[model samples]
Target chain A: MAVVKEEEFEFHTGQNRPAGVPDAIQFIDVHKTFGSNQVLRGLSMGLPEGKVSMILGPSGTGKSVCIKHIVGLMYPDSGDVVVAGHSIPSLSDDDLFELRKKFGVLFQDGALFGSLNLYDNVAFPLRQHTEKGEDEIAEIVNRRLSEVGLGNANEKMPNELSGGMRKRAGFARSLVLDPEIVLFDEPDSGLDPVRTALLCELIKEVHAENGGTYVVITHDIMSARRVAEYIAVLWRGRIVEAGPSQELFESENEFVRQFLAGESSGPLGME
Target chain B: MNELFALPREWLAATGEIGRFMGTVMGDVWGGRVLHFFGESLRQAGILIVSSTLVIWALMFILGLICGTEGAYFLEANGAPAYAGVFAAWCDLREIIPYAFGYMMAAKVGTGIVAELGAMRISDEIDALEVMGIDSMTFLCATRLLAAWIVLPFLYLAGMGGAFLASYIAVVQQVGFVSSGGYLLIFWEFQNPPDFLFSLIKAMVMATAIVLVGCYYGYNAGGGPVGVGTATAKSMVLNLVLVHLIGMLGTQVFWGNNPNAPIGG
Candidate 1:
């Protein structure tokens, strides 16, 4: 990890998963482009091992793209995305898959299967990845469902559930596998402040409960303040500012100041 | 004209397109999903029981009826004792129940497969699965394929029952054949069970092929909702056509021109 006259920070999720746990989801000189537009230009950031690393950026700032590389969903045009212990570029399909089982992710939309009842949706990963008997699956599914405070909602489908419930259900599914890393694409989107606060609390609870790393990608400033142990401020495909919540807030960087202060005119572009 | 390619080089500088397009497919059919928790464990166990028994029993009962009736029908038409019932049971149970309608089930389940996977891709749900360390293909494809394999033959048996029902109706309606007489007559001529068994094997093979192909197209589907729909349609049409072709080919390769071989008429 590079220290560029910024606040050096580290936090733990309590579990020292030594033989199994990883250091960081690392990216080195990563680059990506879409035709004429460059989405990620030399974006390099090591998501901290276990603590929540909230990526704060405006829309279309490649936060989602950054995580996508970590999961090997998209290959960077150049450079590397190494997660856990495997160099993503060097991994075979099977190896990539094995590497991926370490992380859990929550999408912005929740992306629940409409055809599946909530119970089945939560149990989907278990059934797909294991040969456990129904009795065993039911127990785990029930427990996870209850953990999200939706044990009764198991019979309901995604469509039947509210937006908040759906996201929570997605959260439950992510935790089902007990992954080492959990990534949230946008936890605060479409959520009310109270609900968002509850979500933040749940994220903290999840981290505390499971002791796994979490990378939250969000534009919501309040959320960054609420749940983040570390923050990476992305601007123009470059992390223009980053550090502890207070460090970045109290920093002298004009870019960070403009962004934090919500200024319209500054280093941050309107477009 | 070739220098047009050089334009990107000029703009982006020396671009390294790593890993040349090798035609070699990840040919290995590797890995399957294992249930982790109690509910999930139970659900997987149930999929085999529910999907298979329901499909098979329904199909088998339908086939029994078709055979009984059709045998009687042939017997009545020929004025032979229970001969039509015999023929019906022989033909429907041995061939129609296992292969003909098996092809239909393959189509039913294959189309379903396309839609499920297609929807996932279009909705970015698959991307979600990936980031979670969940292998979407293994989970989705394995479960669906398991269901298809489990249920298809059963559905085929159900079709067999329909045939049996038709045969019985046909036989009973015929001018002057005793109901029990037809069954008895056909029973006397029962040659071998392998005929039915072979057809069932063929059905299983066809079902596997249909499912794998459906999963392949569905998993690889890129377009979106429209693409998923297209995939479903394509998977169905292609499955039916391919199953038909395979059936014919299987007939030729496995049972063609052989006397006393349990081949379809």
Candidate 2:
């Protein structure tokens, strides 16, 4: 990590500890602006392959925007996002879509197709991307549903399910394709503490079993403590500090220390 | 000066944007890229058939009855009650039925799509589809356009049959100014197969525009439920304007110079 200017980013030491593994995803000086509001300003970071990494940031700190860039749903204004060695911005539309197959994203709301039940929602990617017959699809869909503890709820529509159930169903759908990189955008959002813990446990269990790169975008400190092996604390579109979760929790930097400690009296304030 | 032209400039910009969007969707369909999602297209076709068919036909039937009654009374007042079928033929086949079909499509299918896709957009369902490696535009919009192309012609033709039947009933049975045989003879004499084909073309054009406009507004909808509502309203307004524009142009292009009536000849 490079030290930024003294006035603008005084607390930003930009200390990014090496993951000791090749990056599965990289944001190279990426900058994104929506109208006059710049969301990501020179955001450069990397997520280690084959690990559960969490992008820990305060609310409205471009955390979810990072996930979009990783999956090619958004393009940066001035920089590149490299995923699995492919430059996302440079790829043609066909190639971009092909590269997206490596990713499975769970949106905040689950975003399950309202028209499809849990069973069909989980089966949707398979039905569109695979030539497998209904029997095979059902087998896979049932297994994924059971893994999410929604086996009995397969026939339920998305609207019929609770928020936690919908998120779990979305998790099942994300994993159905057996993607190489799975991104969860605020998996703990709109859930009780117990359900959030359980969802985090599910993430850990799934990561351990599958052995793929997993990135969870969230501001939940408890979730970060439980699920993230690698942690990136971002603020103002730039990474303040990022490293192994244990190291990040023990950091001496003011902003990282205060944020990871969930303290209010620090350089961070309501702006 | 800039302020003076601002509204028209904004309108031109929006029109250009819509044109580009529609061009992309049209290209996807024409270039057969939409066929990659042919199953989705078929699903949309089925939905159109199930959800919109009856409503459209019912509206056309009602309009047909109005046309028939109006034509019958007008011809009878002119001491040409026997020529009632000629009025009914032109009304039902050349003008009223097509306009009725456009009106119903704008009200029912077009607004329905705007609401459905607008909800999807606001809820991040469209984003989910994109992240899933699916081309959301082709899956969501182009497939719909293809579906409309596939299903609407048949639906329109069937609705036209309903309209024709209603016209016959209103003229021969309800109005009773002309007998069934007299109405049948003049009606058959007035409209040939070409007129039906022309009318079908008009209605099909309106359907295409309505579906495309619905897709544009819905797919780009933002701001949340209120935004979706706004988009639905905007799509309805644009669809109605387009319906009337296409209707007027169709009439002029198809039947302006030659009324295509046996009596006129």
Candidate 3:
């Protein structure tokens, strides 16, 4: 395991938003380690506001860890994570919880409560955070479910849905809160190509309508090409390259080129 | 040698973690969210009863029968056949029932909780709860703990009643060592209110420990399916040891200096 110190990289403190594009989230030289494994080493990047961004990386990279840090499920060992101008590492517990109200995360498996049906799962955050009447909650839940193409599957248990349907349900649940930031971790992990394409289209449509910052973490090159407005390629616990989606697609960086092309022979060895 | 040293260190760390978990649960019990999750916790209690109560009742009943039969044979051979009723009542009510309930609880309820929460942890449902700004500790661990604390006492009382009934049937009706009237008279003669209270306390304490241990292992579970299985197994082992220790401690605290028998004193 290679250890990259925080001093090795120049940190962008987010005081100055990138030119013509406001960053919705920024990681300034964040470092995290799990025992002997250094998962995120001086990692720094930013996701532009009101756009669809994808963190593209290999399987063992810290893509999921990045999502966790953004949500305050995990904290950095060093440096800071700033979400919508608030420093994540400095927020108190109550403040962090308040901060999380601005976020909606969809885990790879949907993370739907096994005991609750689809309707209840989508309505969970609203029920916990707000005092909305059942009638209004029902309206909002139905609309979001319909938006994600899960309108008729309201009564189904998570275990009863197909992999693609589960992902769609998760997407609907994530949107029910009308969050300012929506994060999806590996949204197309187990779906077929056709299903992936449909899900990608649904995500794009959702982003277009909601107009919030949406960050997707995945290794699917096809999905990235289809849905990403911004792309960050992560490797070996660092950002290999990051920029606008078109620019990143045309990146001249050897590692980014090899990873985007899915070529076997490149800086990223088979190991 | 390293394994031996590491074992105790790990145990101490786990004990501290359980203590912290219990503190958080207690804090949540007083928070506004307690009532919010009460119905859900009660639903969990209902599930706990459905899953573990019958097994608890059956196990205690069989043990009661064994105690009665064994006591009768020895007392009759010793030329004091009438004492069989007193022995059965005293032993079953005072010690065996609580211990039996603890064992069955560790085996059934503890492992069940570990499996359920382990599955939740691995599947990211717990993380989803946190991400949604719900206190997963309060919602998941505290609710289960509250449910166990509420329902376990009643379950123990029911199991105790079943044990006494089984003992009566075994000693007086089945074994024919004593008449029904004679057994009932002597049994009530030896039973005391404090003994029942102490036994109930023991059951509740053991139940709390079981819940805390299960939640700790499950909430922190990692790896995958194999990790979940390992967590469940570890919860069972810890619960068994803690149950025995708590049982002994409760017995000493409640009945050690003063054996509060109805007639003997």
Can you give the lDDT of residue A47 in candidate 1? Answer: 65
lDDT of 3 by residue, B1-265 (tens): 9988998999798778778877787778766566677877998889888888899999999999987888888899999888888789867987788889888888888888888889999999999988887778888888888888788888889888889988888888889978888888888887689878988888898888888888888888988999999999888888888988987788678766664442322
The DockQ of each candidate is 0.42, 0.86, 0.78
| lDDT tens digits, residue span A78-148, model 2 | 88899999999999999988888878899999999999989999999999999999999999999999998
For residues B18-76, what per-residue lDDT tens digits would candidate 2 score against the true structure?
99999999999999999999999999999999999999999999998998899999999
In candidate 2, stretches whose alpha carbon ends up further than 4 angstroms from where it belongs are A1-6, B259-265
Alpha carbon lDDT of residue B172, candidate 1? 61
Q: Give the TM-score (vs. native) of candidate 1.
A: 0.71
Question: Could you tell me the C-alpha RMSD of candidate 2 in Å?
Answer: 2.3
Better of 1 and 3 by DockQ: 3
Q: Quick one: ranking by TM-score, best first? A: 2, 3, 1
Write the number of the candidate with greater DockQ, choosing between 1 and 2. Answer: 2
Top-DockQ structure, candidate number: 2
What DockQ would you assign to candidate 3?
0.78
Predicted model with the maximum lDDT:
2
